[model samples]
Target: MIYVDPSGDDSGPGTVERPFATLQRARDAARPGTVVTLRAGTHRLTDTFLLTAAHSGTVYQAHGYGTPYQEKVVISGGREVTGWTPSGDGTHRADAPGPAPRQLYADGLRVERAALSLDGHTLRRTAGGYTVEGTGPQRWDGDVEFVYRGAYPWSEGRCRVASVSGDAHATTLTMADPAFAQATRLYHSVLTWEGPGAGESYGVDSPTSVENSPAFLTEGTFATAGPVIHYRPRGGEPPAGVAAPVLETLLHARGAHDLTFRGITFADATWLRPSTPQGFLHYHGNGYYDGGALETVTFAEGQGQVTVPGDHASMPGNLIFEDTSRTTLEGCRFVRLGAVALEFRGAGAGNTVRDSEITDIAGGGLVIGDGARDHRVENNHIHHIGLDYRGSPAVLVTGARDTVIAHNEVADVPHAGIVVYEGRGTKVLNNLVHDTMRVLADGGGIYVSGPQGDSHANGALIRGNVVRDTITPYNFGLYTDYGAAYVTVEANAVHRADAPVVLTVWPPLEHVTFLGNVWDADPGDPPGGVVLKDNTTVAGDAFDSDPRAVAITRAAGRRPARHRH
Candidate 1:
């Protein structure tokens, strides 16, 4: 077995006795049957590690080792930033090694993107920017961002501050980027205005934006002025608590078989999205129907499902396994990364992500089965994701066949829970999804759409899942939108939702089935050629009830464990 210790020398022989200091040396020393073990400590990664078929092992055997939940092995993508110079304005400045990072951590915890309050103000969209009335507390530092809370379906408005004008009574922010159509203000007022989209410290009841102006500077807020990061501690300590992200991806496995990433931890990576306009899987209504490409008011041209994205969504991830079969990412923790955690795409069949925890990420979590087949996403807990976009799913699976999404526990997310779009024979079963639509609207806990255009989704299975506490008015517990056909919704429990189920497409949906399911509330009128049979309510509890309606007071989301490996 080849070994890697953080304290070892890179020039060593890579043996356990003469261990190597870096994983690259250990990986280079490994053969088809070789095993590489990482000694428990932090391994900082400045670049992505590629695992190809050259690194594949025998069938049902693993080539990499860290001991599942038994080791404290961390593969970090962030560099330590020390040598803080107090700027005397309640903030400290530090020079970093690489390009400036959009995400930073202090005291071993993820720091908040800067923001200020816009409470008790009126906002107006302008030709050049958006202006806030009754000027709140927002102050512009070297540069600041204008972000907003979405009141409409699938909306988030974010732009850099080009100029800040007006007096203390009112402030007009000339945005560097145009607002998204969904982010544009509807009618007059909204629940609140928001920006920079940070967690917790970002308010819930008031208008909030990340402000860097000296007037809004306080402890625990970090922003960039050219190449330096400005910070202020909560209690005014030394700048030792601050850390900045530098790298893009952590572990990237491509076209390898029988590889296992067991019990590894990935932390502190940054993925700053490009300032291009991006949208969700669906356009709600007013779509072009052909699915060729879409153009929004601001995001005009070149938007399609397999089409390359214009921004950081196209960047690499923390743990990426692609085009490999029988590969497993088991019992791992991916935290505080700037991009997606655990993405499996491109023709990797029979891959599995199980017993993992993914949280505190800026993008989507645990994406698998893009054109891949027979993938399993089971028994994982994913939460607190989409730190930037308000409409990203926790677990997104698209363009794959015979993919199984089962037994996952997803909660507290910004948007939807599990979204299965495109391909055929996709099964979503027995997963618990709650507290979704926490930020954006018009989504589903278990949402299914796509094949796009005149094409339709066929032979999809959505069953035995429990979804609750959906916060938005348009988000449902389960939904099939954009001409999904021949899909089956059966034997599930969905409650505490804006609506239990929604099937809409103008002329309505076709070839959809609702059987043996339990809903807290029935879906409104469906379209032609829809079938609803033996579907019950929350009173009957799996027993037969009234002639017109049945009551199901408890969750019907029960199943026997299926081990498909």
Candidate 2:
């Protein structure tokens, strides 16, 4: 066993009496089947911790993972910024010259970005810029961003601000080149019901809000002016600690096998690609379409709406595992991250992430990418995600084979809670999902789409889950969209959604069965090739009173003894 402690020296022997200072030192000294025990403290990382095939059969565990004396062990990817001085204004300033961070944590809580809402104002799109009524300032500090709600109910796009003109009550904010044009050319504003070819053409509406300007700097918000970062404390109280994320990834494993990580907190990592001039022109879930690679396709589903290219790029993760097989991560915490917390890429097999907590992220919580096989994600509590990018889901499984997503509690997301898009033998079982689609629409607490497998032997099963309180404007409790087929949804409970279940027929669903399910609303008659049998409908308030509903809710989500904190 190798030992690592924050207060130890690097030259010391990796023993309990004289532990090594850094994790890299311990990792380098380790052989196969070595257990690297990390002491209970924050281990800050300057660069990503890399693990290759040489690090196979290794276990990186916390000091007291299964003991009563277990304490917190944090792996941080943020650098401390000191010397805060007042800049004569209300905000405090500090010289934190580095890669621009998309997220900031003050006293271990997320501080909001400086923003101004233009919801009730008259803002018109212009040739060079937008002409807005009742503008606040003549000029602003830092790089500004226009946060737009376009693509109807699916996407939330952003564009960089180039320059501001005009004076006093009226302002013309010229958006930066290429990005603004790309955003406008991709994200459509009109719905499919508007006309026969309404959504075919590319268009974007006025921005719902503007972000990262000095004029928007207020209590509990922060902004940046070039290399200097500024923060205004809530109620004028000073922050005890502030973390500015520097590294995009904290851990990256490739071609490693037989690894385990237990009871470690990976925190404060940022992805800066979205903050660049390229901007985040969101498409669906965690994906965004690039304008340079323009390949538009038409989906016959739902009034023949146009779709972006299928090969869209997803938001990158802060912790990535690429082609790493037989890896397990348990009792870990992924928090305060700017992008996807963890991702499984390539054709990795037999990976598991269980008994973990993921929260306070700007993007998706977890993503099992295409080509992966036999992954298990269980008993995790994922909440308060999509904090910056509103279109990102809580958990997404795309094109993985024999993936099992079970016994997880997902909540407090702006978009879908759990999305399964194209996979074989995928089992989504005994999970509790709630309060999804709080901002964006056309998704659900549990959403499934695309073909499950080639035949019934490898078909998907979504069973014994409880989904409740899918917040309105629009959404469903359970949704099957965009050519979902060869799937069985059984023994699930759904309540308090815009609709109990929405099985789209425009794309012509095939061999999808809904059996022994309970909901507050009936979805009416089944379409061709779809079967709805042994399903019951109850009153909306019956979710609290009904014994079956209460039992299902109690049985779902994280198992009682498995929670880490």
- Estimated TM-score per prediction? 0.80, 0.95
Stretches off by above 4 angstroms in model 1 are 58-69, 87-90, 119-126, 130-139, 163-173, 177-215, 275-316, 451-458, 505-507, 539-565
* Tens-digit lDDT string for candidate 2 (234-264): 7776654887988899999999999899989
Candidate 1 per-residue lDDT, tens place, 407-491, comes to 7888888778888766778888878888988877878888877642222254788877778788877788887876677688887
* Root-mean-square deviation of every model: 7.4, 2.4
Error of 2 at 405 (Å): 0.5
In candidate 1, position 143 carries an lDDT of: 53
In candidate 2 the C-alpha lDDT for residue 34 amounts to 95
Evaluated with lDDT, which candidate comes out highest?
A: 2
How displaced is residue 374 in candidate 1, in Å? 1.2
